[model samples]
Target: MSDKPLAPAIEGWHTMGDQPHLIGTRCTACGTYFFPKQSHYCKNPDCDSTDFEEVELSRTGTVWSYTNACYEPPAPFVAPQPFEPYAIAAVQLEAEQMVVLGQVVTGVDTEQLSVGMPVELVLETLHETDDDIKVTWKWKPVAA
Candidate 1:
């Protein structure tokens, strides 16, 4: 029983911590960064090795694209009783060579967002319960 809050994700699994993190996969032949992870096999067509190693991703990235969720998400995702509009965006991690999509933090002014804007990842609590707390990733515009 650790003092840390129990994560909504799998328990006992080490948390990614406060820093923006990205998943990385080494080609074994030619190193390459991968997000969402290539668990099955390497995407580098030239190599057939089934071996891969996980690596932490970058914290900052540039916005590749963005959209607003005018409606509430369906199913198991719990939201506030009245519902609120949220923003989702795809951030391109140049170092990882991949695009990671996540919800924007609350109070963001959508009109101020733009493509190619610099952003950084932040860990936030989405929901909580007596035993578990749902945590997810979010992105915010970099401070000027």
Candidate 2:
């Protein structure tokens, strides 16, 4: 845990606090949801509407898939020194019915994950900067 003031690693992508949620947009016409906040235009083939509204996507979901990152990724991701492999999961949100990818919480094993396993969003320190503690959303398994 860091005493530095918390800040989002990628601003405006998700909320912060005890109950953080991924911020996304919903197509006003077809009621479709998109992460990364799709305000430009709907990707739905049948809908050419440019109208969209911001919505806080569901925090709980089932794990649609899982994998691990064995090496440091490209920029925008600040990996720690002597980087440790981390689990990644594609979770299908309970409300949106869409899969959103995220890093799994630290120390969770790949063998512990499974398709359709329930999970929830949680905030964790991704890395630290001179001025703030960079936080990001992570998927944590819901204890049965």
Candidate 3:
């Protein structure tokens, strides 16, 4: 087997890197942007265009909201055997004018986060098996 890590948990969202940015689609008709990409059509209600272009979303954004998960998540979400609470954040990408939700980097608790704080995208291991490791993107608070 190859040594490279397995494919991302969610495909077409981002690529692994020291400075990873979310991949999204932008409408050439009305300038609307969408995360997870809308390959078929633009999401804006006023726009009925099917033309779109792939673009890398901004790396930095302000925290729009946040919360801490004090309990184990539902199935499909694999937590460590000895479960620990984790924080989730809704970050607003400035240029895109959209908010994307993701888990916060380890060690950042609800007490240490605030709305409007700057955050950046990061790649982290979600789970691992004998053959490969699953990776996902996360949000981390940016140092001033």
TM-score of each: 0.83, 0.94, 0.93
The CA lDDT at 125 in model 1 is 63
| Runs of candidate 1 exceeding 4 Å displacement | 1-14
lDDT agreement of model 1 with the native: 0.74
Please give, for residues 39-124, the per-residue lDDT of candidate 1 as tens digits: 56777777776777777777889999999888888868778768888888899988667788888888885786899999998766
Q: Which ten residues in a row have the lowest lDDT in candidate 1?
A: 6-15
Estimate the overall C-alpha local distance difference test score of candidate 3.
Answer: 0.88
Return the lDDT, model 3, position 131.
68
The best candidate by lDDT is 2
Flag the better candidate by lDDT, 1 or 2. Answer: 2
Ranking by lDDT: 2, 3, 1
Write candidate 3's Cα lDDT for 65-123 as tens digits. 99989999887988887988989999998888899999999899999999999999998
lDDT for 39 (candidate 3): 73
Candidate 1 TM-score to native: 0.83
lDDT of 3 at 134: 77
**Model 3 alpha-carbon miss at residue 28, Å:** 1.1
lDDT of 2 by residue, 1-144 (tens): 668999999999999889999999999999999999999889999999899999999999999999999989998888998999999999998779789999999999799999999999999889999999989999999999
